[model samples]
Target chain A: MKQIEDANQEALRRMLAADPVLVDVLPAAQVIPELTDRMILHAGPPIDWERMCGPMQGAVMGIAVFEGWAPDLETAANMAAEGAFEFHPNHHFDAVGPMTGMTTLSQPVMIVENRTFGNRAYCTINEGLGKVMRFGGNDDEVLKRLAWLRDVLGPAMGKALGAGDGLPLKSLVARGLSMGDEMHQRNVACSGLTLRGLSPAMAETANDTHDLAEALAFVAGNDQFFLNIAMAMGKAIMDPVRGIEGSSLVTAMSRNGTDFGIRVSGTGDTWFTAPVEMPEGLYFPGFTEKDANPDMGDSTIVETIGLGGFAMGAAPAVAGFVGAGAASGAANFTRTMGEITVGENPEWTIPALDYLGVPTGIDIRLVVETGLAPSINTGIAHKEPGVGQVGAGVVRAPMGCFRQALETFAESVGVS
Target chain B: MSETKVNQFLKTPVKVVNIGLEGFAKELEQQGVTVVQVDWAPPAGGDPKLADLLSKLGT
Candidate 1:
């Protein structure tokens, strides 16, 4: 037990000490050397085409077409079914994405370097909400937007970021929390802060005025723009915490619509999975629970590093939007989560909780003992592919995965 | 025999604290008895094997 405790503390130290900087933006294939042609990386744990939820399948079809592997969505779908393409979880390639997280070779990916550990993590840009590929919309409109991101915004931001040393994310996230952005369902403040940091460089780096204005307007227009950066930041922070022997700290928690999976520090890359849960919250008009897909995405990585739902107390404004409850009730979610974690992140504190650090380091031992699953604030996608976002809400990580992780962890430590 | 302590206690105003399932607490509330419901479940969702492993880890 002491060994486990020590290992967990070391894991927490590495996580808290992480310096995730927005270093560059480039095509996925350019940065992730393992991403080969026709190889598509998706969100959550490893899942095959047959088992992928409608949205994920839809996104994959869209990406296949976007990559020119197929002539159309129809062809893409057929190709996917026929095994014309390879699918792997984004986590496998040191990347993460949100919703029906579809990361392909051609899509532009934000690169965040953990300067302290000299490792990097990647994530594709957030296609501004609705009828976009991340939520499984794969029509011409979606393809066009993906192309724009790949051609314009990605390079502009990459040039801006390159103009100087990359923007460090820790302080920006802290400031966002102070201004009511939880870096998950709500990232309004951080998005603005990120634009303010990059707009100047973007203006100077752009080849022309029109391109600069378009790029600036795009970042300013999309409120969840920073969510992708946050996902990459979370990935950057947590990657270093992986493989700490005897540590029970969770390194990743994600869902692929069909299944929710978690990887623990001690267990290496093995994913303990269970049937995913549907989000419970307010839906957009004309939509209801029946239209919502089970929760999905690699964005829960934010919560793994003590943001998102774990920092909900700092963003009370998100409570009503996510249907968590009245603004005052938000702090209770963070408080309940504290019991299941190994420690608190001092740098990311909630003023509402008297400057208490956000709960960090999810410990499987505590999760099993307390029977409290990690709560995630998330966007609800329609179950039918290409329908776009249905709503936003909160969902709990299934306990079955934690139980399995604990059982294996105990056995691994010779507990028999 | 005269009323036992249990009987005497039952004769007084009834107040209850309920944990786990909320049905009992709801029933008590419907009967006008004061009740405090605590949201809880059997650790590990009542999975015996997980509970055993948890105990082994000294949780």
Candidate 2:
């Protein structure tokens, strides 16, 4: 018994010690290649960000003007068309961007470095879903909002976060599960708790009454803001176990405009992919399947690590957006998901099971046997060429991808 | 029947959830309710919502 416990501890330690990064990450201009408006950086694999359809493209254009790379939308468009600037993906830079998933040179991002493994990951703030830049619309209002986020909100949160002790995202995620937040669609309580945790620091650096009030309201209004913390934490926890010999654990799952890709623990960065499809679920007013974009973005990594839609019981309200009885099904889903995983997340946990750890480290072999793929909550972009976002919903990672991953992993490990 | 009336059929204590899962049906029978789970796949071009749970259990 003691030996088994020790083995678990060692495995966990090794997982925590992998690929961690430590640094303050600013926007793309400060740390990444120049982002042109025409360059569309989709998740999973390399695709042109500019060629992306709908709200996603709009978001990229918005990021360009905010970065001062272009004086106006037309200039941004011209630069992209003429290749005046380079377009790189958020994933390539060890970062994940939200919808339209655009990260530009000047934007500030959360720089969480795993001191143990020395691997780093970055992600920008959530644009609150509706009318946000990542969804692909480049309107005047979207650009203005981007400017405010960079100039005011980003710096304020950075100072508050910097002055305080390193924010322990793992604890917040556990608390979120207890308080009706799946850490995806319904982060109302978690967002409040996060803002409250940083309140003292924010108050000290706020400088004036107006700035403080605005910052509080911004955090208060966005329910899904805690998503980035979940993403970064997931990245941190999973980075350690990558490239483990004979391990069939799935390391990362994400989607580009063209395909869905996943990396396995046994293989180093080899992506198994499948054609993308639209997520099936309830939509907002006047939006139909016709308006929804195919799966896109790295947010699904949150689910792969067992937080987002997987813990639906944590956020019952998501049923309204995804499906009825999602709370019960979500619990069953996560519970079954645990059956398919090698172990539980050490640092992050869900409070529903008297503080049971969130299921972590998806095993491809287990998924093949159980016939259950990971469930993801996602924002739907319009299917049409240039329409923005149509709605949001839940989806399952296709089983074929996992089957292929399992077969390939079995071969590599010399197993029948 | 109206949608509300149709929903009322499910509110009764002796109700059946017809989803082609025999295990669930047998379990329901153990609770003293008459449940006959059957593989009643609805024909094509039908209202899926009405046909899915009702047709399988409807005597």
Candidate 3:
């Protein structure tokens, strides 16, 4: 048993030691091996279109039109109803997306490689905050932006990234934490940093000056530009820790609009899920609880790797979004999360903790024992598709899932 | 600035001496982490049957 724990610790070490490099940007079909036509990769565990929440369904419809499989919204909706598409989770394919988190053959994704572990992870490029397809916005404007991302931003980024072996994301994330960006709700600083990192490459490689300027400008204007990269980094780092027999650490935590789910390291690819919880959040003007969708997205992969809410103490500005309403309360929340995690990530230090590493590995056993499920800070999408973002807030991964994982893990360890 | 000590929990065997968040401690206990309770009944005897107990429970 002690040896098992040691193995788990080693797996976690390798995960934390990962230096994910931003390698390229390409269409999902090009990067993700199994992503074929007629397949849509949504968040969390698998579900058929019939069971998908409104936002996810909406995103899928947008992608259908974007792929030219359907010419209009009405036809796309009918195609979805008729089960013309195969829906799988981003987790199933080593990919993730924010909100409804559906990735299609045409959607552009960032490719990040773990320098130490030699594995790669993918996340669709963020569609920049409002009325985007990932949140179920299937309107023309929404589809247009996604097309631009697919055509312009993706290629420019691919060239910029290929200009070097790739930028090291580990140090960038650590620096973001110190600069008051939790890499979840508040990526203002990190996005700016990304622009700085890519500008030279973009400048050097872009054939057209206007395209380079537009791409740099687009990344600069969008605060969440760093989020997809961060999620890929999280996936790149955490994927190596999955399936270590006898280890109790959580390798993944995410939600499709309908359910919140987690995968444990020792448990392999099996998911422990609970009903998605509504967030206690600050709403945008004219939007309230009713407008907010249940928690969703592969974005919580950030928390699974101990950024997001676990590093909130470093990004006090995220307090309002966290329902804490103040910097000190956010800091306390981060400290409390420490109780459920195995240890600090020595590399990803938080300034508020006086350079202490953010809480790293979430041990399902410890989470169940501590009665504290992992905390997540996330963007709240509209309950209906196409309404875009409604607000942002804090949520706890339901304790029930962790409890179930503990029971199974206990049984595996022969602890009756 | 003085050097901050590494978090002791990282080095020692897992154990939690919980003060107010007993639900947290209970989950940890269920998961095989060592948890020691602080015998607290709250400042004012907290809610009675407010099956809205999640609110009454400390976060």
Candidate 3 lDDT, A308-414, residue by residue in tens: 99888989988876576777787777787888787888888887778888888887755654566678898888999778887889888987787667667666665
Q: Model 1: what TM-score? A: 0.94
- What's the lDDT for all of these models? 0.92, 0.66, 0.83
Best of the candidates, TM-score: 1
List pairs with backbone clashes in candidate 3: A368-B27, A368-B28, A369-B27, A369-B28, A369-B29, A370-B24, A370-B27, A370-B28, A371-B24
- Chain B TM, per prediction: 0.72, 0.38, 0.49
Q: lDDT, candidate 2, residue A237?
A: 60
What lDDT score goes with residue B32 in model 1? Answer: 99
lDDT string for model 2 (A50-110, tens) is 5555455455556567667678777776676676656655666677765557766566777
Model 2's alpha-carbon lDDT is: 0.66
The model with the greatest lDDT is 1
Global Cα lDDT for candidate 3: 0.83
DockQ for all candidate structures vs. native:
0.57, 0.03, 0.03
After superposition, the stretches of candidate 1 with alpha carbons farther than 4 Å from their true spots are: B1-38
Q: What tens digits encode model 1's per-residue C-alpha lDDT throughout A24-59?
A: 999988988889999989899999999999999999
Interface RMSD of each: 1.5, 17.3, 11.9
